[model samples]
Target chain A: MNTFLQLLNRVNSRVLFFGLLFVSLFLIVRNNEAQGKIFLNSAGRVTGFFGSGATAIGSYFNLRRENEKLQHEISVLRGQLAKDQYNTQVNIDTLQRVLDSTRIQIYKYIEATVVNNSVDKPKNYLTLNRGRHHGVKENMGVITADGVLGVVRYVSKYYCIVMSVLHTDSRVSAQIRGVDKGFYGSLVWRGKDPRFMQLIDIPKHNKISSKEDVVETTGFSTYYPPGVTIGKVFYHSIPPGSSNHLIQVKLNTNMANVRYAQIVVNVHADEINQLEARAKDEQ
Target chain B: MNSSSTLRISLKFIIIWILQIIVLKQVQFLPLGPYYYEAFVYPLFILLLPFGMHVNRLMLIAFFSGLLIDASYNTLGVHTASAVVLAFARPYILALVLPRGIDEAFTPSLGRLKFLPFLRYVIYAFLVYLPFYYTMVFFSHVFIVEIIVKSLLSFIVSVFFTLILAGILNGLD
Candidate 1:
């Protein structure tokens, strides 16, 4: 005990010195970001390099499980395709409507590895290995095999950052599957759990039930394609003073363990946005 | 200071940092419970700082270590701020809990202390560290109750791991 205390006293100054330096560095970095001078980009690259390396190691260990998951996904897709072919005669109008509404063609599924992900906070973001060189661009939608993940927020030459669906600032136009009209809701991660996200601004008039509803993207936002799965409603309640229902969605994608993902770059997103802007100008 | 000791300390820090960034961070013991509890290895850096190190210096190292972890994890400044705070409070916590005449220059070690004193140190460390860590992580939100609960839970789990690490390091030394 005496020796331990002696060591503690001796090292106290060193500890304090390092501690203060850290605090000052943190303050400088935080403050500098507000001034638009980011000194941490180099640090970010170093960290990113380490992160990507770690991710590679992790993926190596989980290869068997990932392979199984991919195989199952492939079979599921094949079954769905077969079923769709069979139902085409019975639902010609529905098929035509779906085809007409899908203006964007996803030419290829650009697989990117997630080097970093933040889901515990309000404004979560994800970093991917692919960027402009891989045909990935801003406004591209990202997803794992399970469901919708998020949209690309920033793109660099070889890497891209995605603002996750759990972000408070993430407003995706979505609705219950098969519902004609869509509603706008802000996705907010409650911080209690990562598997579930809270959807706000859903009108109280909409009929909702636990475990019975499927939420999908409305394609109103250029970031996601129509009918892409978002999550399933698990629980909902009307806040006391508001007319909107507070709905909790159990996300289909296990985001914490997501490894490989596809970034969907809609071919016609720019043209559609431009046309809409012109139409609004004429109006 | 001997060159060997400095080299050893630097090596330890580097090894721990790499293990934390590469191995421990990937260990997600998920589906275990409701909150997706995962082992966080960053606190081990704080626990392993040389005894008698200056509080400010310790904070700086802890902060940089945390910032590196945060940058890699894309958590921005949360880890850096919390780690600095944790390092700053360690000395005060030690003074408040440990008995007098415990030699001032002696670094903290489980092997050097009685069970009760060691337990007190562990508890104090958790109390000082957990709240700051969780607060920074959840800074944007105002859920005080959730914050307290999550912090406490994380503290309990992380403290266990820290104690084990401390024990192992002391045993090796």
Candidate 2:
């Protein structure tokens, strides 16, 4: 009985030490699982709670800059409108002189504020303040004052997530403004600086100008209106082993400081999408 | 049993968590190619836990810290699992590195050891961490080369950062 007590004591101490070690390791690991849900929930709550305050502060700081930009845009639009009104006769004459010159389309824009922006990841997403409640939906085109941002990927009641141009999965059918040969290329973030992006799959046969040619959407994709500005081709090179030319595009939109944006909701989007889907099915 | 010590530890954890979540999380220096790699600064928390702490307590602390970090980074349970592994391995590592006579009551601290012993401790700590960290991250069937490259780069960078942080904490103390 005395020997049994000693043995029990020895066993107890050893068990205790090992047990401590096991529990510590388990807790460290278990913490990860425990923390994930708790952290996310807490982050959401904290951000949601302080979101309004931060927005208010941001707006206050940006008021002057916003006013200045708004003024410049208003003046540019006014100047263009004046020119259109004065050149109505000229436009009519030109329409008669050229084929397909009279085709005019109107676009509606919904303004939204960017709440969160990420540019350094392979799959970058932007969160906006507007959502389904504001008539925003998946695949709607989003653009900043400078140019095209990306397309809306997901939507909630009060928020919408946009898969930015910086994402690997993001591709748009784009063409050189005046060139006849158009190509579908993926917009990829090179994980470098935020100001630059790479346009992949441009055929080597296509002659790319150094400085001035504009890259714009071809309207082949239902998400964007045809001729929406994307960026300008900055540089191109024939990679060592690949046949396609690697084109570097300087994005017009300054992603780092983008705040206010517009979501383009096409009225005929559903019909066009259905027709495209049927065509694909038939193929 | 002391309230002040508990408060100090909690404070330290919060500060480390905030720094990891808010500041270090944003800094991604990619020295490698298109296969994206970034340094994780959360291990400083693990390294900073009080030396010679009870094994279970240490593991619990590491677990909670890992959980907080994973949650912030949106990596579901990877950090927690790896951290727990590190916590469990820490004692064995200490035992292996420490001198025989010092095993009974020795705590891991810069002031408590010579240079070679410190280096050994750091090396062992790093070895314990690397495998678990890499395994959790690359669990999906990925290109072996990419996984190896990323893991190696991340391990090197994280170890260097951990050493610097540990040095700083020691200096401060």
Backbone clash numbers for all candidates listed: 46, 3
> B30-69 in candidate 2: lDDT tens per residue?
6677766666656656655556565555665676777777
Q: Could you say which candidate leads in lDDT?
A: 1
Candidate 2 DockQ, CA atoms: 0.03
Q: Runs in model 2 with CA error above 4 Å?
A: A1-106, A179-184, B1-173
Query: Model 2: share of native contacts present?
Result: 0.02
DockQ of predicted candidate 1: 0.09
* Per-residue lDDT of A141 in model 1: 86
A1-283: candidate 2 lDDT, tens digit per residue: 5574445445543354455445544443444565344545655667678776555677889999999999999877886785633221212232223335685333456777798999877778899877877778899988777677889999998789998877777776777677564665666676677787777888787777656678777787767778777789898788998878888888888887789988877767888889989999998
